[model samples]
Target: MPDLNWQKSSFSQQASSCLYLAAAPDGTVKLRESDNPDVILTTAPATLGALIRGIKAGEFDHIRTA
Candidate 1:
C-alpha cells in the first residue's frame, strides 16, 4: 500500500484521540487511530458502507461496555 490520505471523522472529539479513514488505491478503505497511525485496519468499501448504514440505523446501539 502506498501513502494514504487520512481524514478524521466530523464526530471525533477535538482532542488528539480520534479515528481516521482513507480510501485505498484498490478501492478498499483503511481505518486507524490518529494517535496510533502504525496500527491500521483495512476493509472492503462495500463492507464499510454497510457498517456506516447500520450505525445510522442504530444496529449497534445495544452494544455496551463494561
Candidate 2:
C-alpha cells in the first residue's frame, strides 16, 4: 500500500468523496474511498471486470431501488 499509486474513481468528480484504486505488484486490484483510506478491498482483474459488466447491465439495480 505504501508503494501503490492510488488513483481517484473516474465516476466521482469531487475529490473529497472520491474512491481510490491501486494495483499491487502481485497483480491484485485494491480499492478504497478517499474518506476512509484505511479500509481496502482487494480483487482480481477478471472478477472486477465481471462486476463492472454486471453493473453496466443493470444486474445490481434492485439492490438500490428495491
Report the number of the highest-TM-score candidate. 2
Model 2 Cα lDDT, one tens digit per residue, 16-63:
798887888989999998788889999999999999999999998875
Which candidate leads in lDDT? 1
Task: Please give the lDDT score at residue 1 for candidate 2.
Answer: 38
TM-score of each: 0.80, 0.81
The residue pairs that clash in candidate 1, if any, are none
Candidate 2: stretches off by over 4 Å? 63-66
Q: What is the total number of backbone clashes in candidate 1?
A: 0
Model 1 spans with C-alpha error above 4 angstroms: 13-15, 63-66
Total clashing pairs for each candidate: 0, 0
> lDDT of model 2 at residue 31?
91
Evaluated at residue 26, the lDDT of candidate 1 is 90
In model 2, how large is the Cα lDDT of residue 35?
80
Could you give candidate 1's per-residue lDDT for residues 1-66 as a string of tens digits? 798998987888764799899998898899998778899999998999999999999998896879
RMSD of 2: 2.3
